[model samples]
Target: MRSTFYTEDHEAYRASVAEFLRREVEPHHGEWEAAHGIPAEVWTSAAAAGLMGLAVPEEYGGGGEPDYRYRFVVAEEIARTNTTSFGVGLGLQDDIVIPYLLDLATDEQKQRWLPAMAAGELIGAIAMTEPGTGSDLQGIRTTAVRDGDDWVLSGAKTFISSGMHAGLVIVVARTDAEAGSRGFTLFVVEQSDAGFTRGRQLEKVGLDAQDTAELFFDGVRLTADRILGQEGMAMRYLMERLPRERLSIAAAAVAASEAAVRWTLEYVHSRTAFGQPIGDFQNTRFVLAELETECDIARAYVEKAALALNLGELTAVEASKAKWWTSELQVRATSRCLQLFGGFGYMLEYPIARAFRDARVQTIYGGTTEIMKEIIGREQAARYARR
Candidate 1:
């Protein structure tokens, strides 16, 4: 199906992104996976190619475009290559952290941070999940107490993407112990901070090149200027921006599903069994037909959600629907596609194997599928209550 979601400019951007990935990312992906992370040089290369910050203002050394499609083009091209490592970096920069700074940061904060981030000199990470809390924002135990001219932070975060390499970490900590959700605040914890420490890079079933690790803040001190939003407003800040984060996940899911289906189609056509190509079998044909249809449906819905997000019209419930549905589709699509690859699909060298491993985490992160359903269900119940 033809997509009406992108303009010629978007297509042009996609071409450039594709070329860059083929030249810079694809060749070193195996080396990165072995190293458990990509080098800082790759990030700098991406920045030099204008792949780092599509929505950040040009004055900050970014692309200066607020259009979401430009970001989507990067996501789709990265997904098509089965490159999960770059997905988190791009997603974190474009979808998660950039918006927080752009929308809430003081002019001084923006000026201090945006330029380095755009140049990829500074890598950013959001430390939200703690040893105890995953999606429960109010359950975080990290605390930041006011101390004269500085705030003392003490807490630990686990499963933080880019944790090891992050030059700037936006740590979510409790500022008002008596106020529950309203008490939370975001602090920019620099890597050079005395008490800040990082645990070893975690071994994971997938996304091996993206460093996920544990972060420790044992009375790490921060000045007042490092606070991200207004003190005691971190929860609201996170809530307002989650829709875009979820939509970004949805976009990647759809793109990955399409990639899986395409790869499977090619494999079935070229591989033979019983003296005939597997693609000639009725079972393979039917499976491919079903997958193609599902992929198209998912692509259209995600593109629509992305458009809505670009227009500032995406609601929480809609974003939840997109996130859960597309991620579930990705899991199913990748699993079935792997089965079509027979025994070879299980081999680590094949892209399908890596994609299968990577797809498992998508449903678990970005708010698990169950959590997304709960959000949607609660909204529906509230609507009926009003009725």
Candidate 2:
């Protein structure tokens, strides 16, 4: 479906992003997959192309625009090429890390960090998922105790994206033993800090080019200035910003489904079965028709959600609906598309194989599908109670 969500400026930006990916990223993706990480030079090049930070203030050497459509366009163009690894870096920078800095940082903190982040000289990661806690924010075991002039932190986190390459990590830890969610706080932990160590780069079923790892913080000391926002308000902060994160994931999921449908259509048309093109079969045509309609519906919903998110009006319940529904569609669409490819679908050389593997995590991360349904159900119950 042709979308009216983007304007001419967004279209121009999309063209530039497409060119950059085709020229700079496509050639190196194979090597990056083999290496299990993208090189620092790619980040530098992305910074040079003004692709690193779209919403950051120009004073910090960024685009200074808060329009999310531009970010969505970049994500769509990347998805069109079957590039998932690059999306992780862009999504982390634009969706996850930038908000924490923009919403919580003090003037001095912004000055110290924003420029490097904009320039891609500094990579950022949010350390929240621990060995024991995945989605339970209140169950975090990491602790930060106040000293005279510093805070001592001790904990371990696993499944941290960009952990191995991140120059700055936003560490979430408990500040009060009995306060539950109110006791949590965020701290900026630099890579150079003593006692801060990164564990092995994790190998996963997919997204081979993106770095995911374990992080260790043992007696890591941070000065008072390193704290982000008001202390002991991490849960509040996270709740306020999670809508955009969920919206971003939903946007990417819809884009992936669209790409999968397009790829399958092309494959079916070219490959013959029983001396006839597979596309001539009624089953293939019906499957493509259904997938196409679903993808169009998903894109429309995600586009509306993106606009709501940009206006600061998207709610947790709405985001949860989008996240769960679109991710489930992506998983289903990728699997069906791969099935259309027959034996070739099982080979790693096929993009369908990679997309199938990658789609499995969409429902699991950014809040599980079951978790989303619970949130939506609770909100409905509250509304009924008010009536």
Candidate 3:
């Protein structure tokens, strides 16, 4: 599973991240899960440890090093600890939100938000998915009408990750009602905005520590400066960012699969059945072999995707292939690992159980497995047609 992609610096970074997760996150993750949100202190502590701002520029209290490998270290360590909630929340920030600001935000906008975001003071969330429009960007019903220098925003966003803690949110809204996909715009809604409200914290079957909530924009007025990039550019912005987002999911998926294999390996070796260790049995050995081989392959694929993303050469189709493959691999790995644990795996107290629970949503979010395949398939068909 060793790769030439990581240097000593990456390994050193991994050690630091592992230490932080062990000291700050491991003991308290259960508490956060029960509350359905990681605490503000955790965010601050993560920033202090240089975990939150890998993508942020150095001028803005960040590492300023824009390598995806550092982010991969964070994802892998979180997966090792089985902190999927923390993993997803951090992904929303580092993988998804920061890139928007990096690529699209103006200097003044960056000056206003990046420092706080780097320091974890201004928690950011993107309000995209509605109750009705899962990944259908064209179907978002949220509206923003230009009224003088302000845009009147009226809509509700459900399943918003980091919804409860977000001090700054990028709200996707329809700016031109008749423009279809071109109608959508991205607006930055601050926490203190009038009529902007966060609704009930959603209870999910997994990633319980990540706060997923309903957000309401009841005629919240936003200035022209609050607009990101340009009016009616949300869909394009989304398309541009899709590769990194999906790759982030892929990175986490591979890591989770590896973790599942690691956990099951130890369990099967130590726990005995019949006359010897369960791992000694042919069935367990075969399962372990398949799981390990699959994880190793996933690791290679994700690393390559990460490199491609760094080089700005990662295509949507490539990202989709990685995303769908690793997501399904994670589900399969967790399910198989949990099976090895027998009844103990079904109990919530076991980490394997949490892995099994958390793995279900991997193929569902970041665009479903079916959607990823469709994207890849469509591109392949178009290329073949041209040929």
Candidate 4:
């Protein structure tokens, strides 16, 4: 089905993104991957190309564009180029971290941080996952005790993306143990803070160019001015912003699946089996057909969700549905595509191999497949409550 989600400007933007990836990223991605982190210059280059700050207010040096398709185009072009580590890094900035600051930060906070972020001079990370807690935000054991005029923060956060080079991090900690969910508060911890420390650069199975690490805050003191929004309101803020994050994942998932199908199609048509093109086999045709059809259908749904998100009508439940389904489809589509490549698929040199490797993390991050389903189930039960 032909979708009407993007206008001519979006296509033009897509072209620019593709060109930028070819020039700035493609040649240097491998070195960054081996080095275990993307250089600071790449982020600045992205900002210069107007790719970093999609929705940031113009007065603060952002594009001030509120459209979600621009973000989708970036993800699609990155997937097509198979530079997913860069994609993940950019996604963390635009989808997850920027939104928090845009919506929740005070005017002074905006003045202090937004422009540098828009210019990519200041990299940001959100430290939410602790060693003990994976998806449970309420289970975070980090504490921020209130002093006379400052907050004394103490805790450790693991799996923090952009941890190595992040100049600023949004740390979630419990401020009032008795308040339960309401006790959790968000604080912006600057790198210059006395006790803030970044531990080892975590070596992952994939996304090597993206920095993921452990962060420690041992009695790091922060002023009340550092709080994002109100104190003890992080839970509500996180719940409100999570849908956008999930949709970002969904968009990437669809694009990744499409890229897998594109690679597989080109491969089967060129490679041979039994004295003929591999595509001549019935199984190969059926596999590609199914993958393409599913991707298109998924794209249609994602388009609707993206439109809704841009319009501010997207719900957590709807985004969850998109997240779980599209993520699982990405895994399935890439796996099937990989199998068609025979032994070549297993080789790291193949894009299909990297696609398959990247797809595994999709089902687990943003929110797990099981967690999404559980959210949908709980929402359904609420709607059909037994009185």
lDDT of 2 by residue, 85-118 (tens): 9887889888999889998999999999999999
Q: What lDDT tens digits, residue by residue, belong to model 1 across residues 86-180?
A: 87788988899878899989999999999999998889999999999998889999999989999999999999989989999999999998997
362: Cα error in model 2, Å:
1.0
Q: What residue pairs are clashing in model 3?
A: none
- Alpha-carbon TM-score of each model against the true structure: 0.98, 0.98, 0.98, 0.99
Poorest 10 consecutive residues of model 1 by lDDT? 1-10
Clashes of each: 0, 0, 0, 0
* Model 2: per-residue Cα lDDT at residue 242: 84
Task: Report the C-alpha lDDT of model 3 over 1-387, residue by residue, as the tens digit.
Answer: 356989999999999999999999999999988877888988888989989978798998888988999999998999999888888988998999988998999999999999999998889999999989997778888899989988999989998889988999999999998887788898999999999999998888889989889999999988999999989889999988989999999999999999889999999999998889999999999999998988888888889989999999999999999999999999999999999999999998999999999999989888999999899899989999998
True lDDT of residue 168, candidate 3:
91
Clashing pairs in 4: none
lDDT of 2: 0.91
* lDDT for position 102 in model 4: 96
CA deviation > 4 Å runs, candidate 2: none
For 1-387, candidate 4 gives per-residue lDDT tens digits of: 476788999999999999999999999988988898888988999999988988998999999998999999999998999999999988999999999999999999999999999999999999899999999988999999989999999999999999999999999999999998899999999999999999999988788889899999999999999999998899999999999999999999999999999999999999988999999999999999999999999999998999999999999999999999999999999899999999999998899998898889899888899999999999999999964
**Deviation of model 3 at 108, angstroms:** 0.7
lDDT score of residue 69 within candidate 2: 90
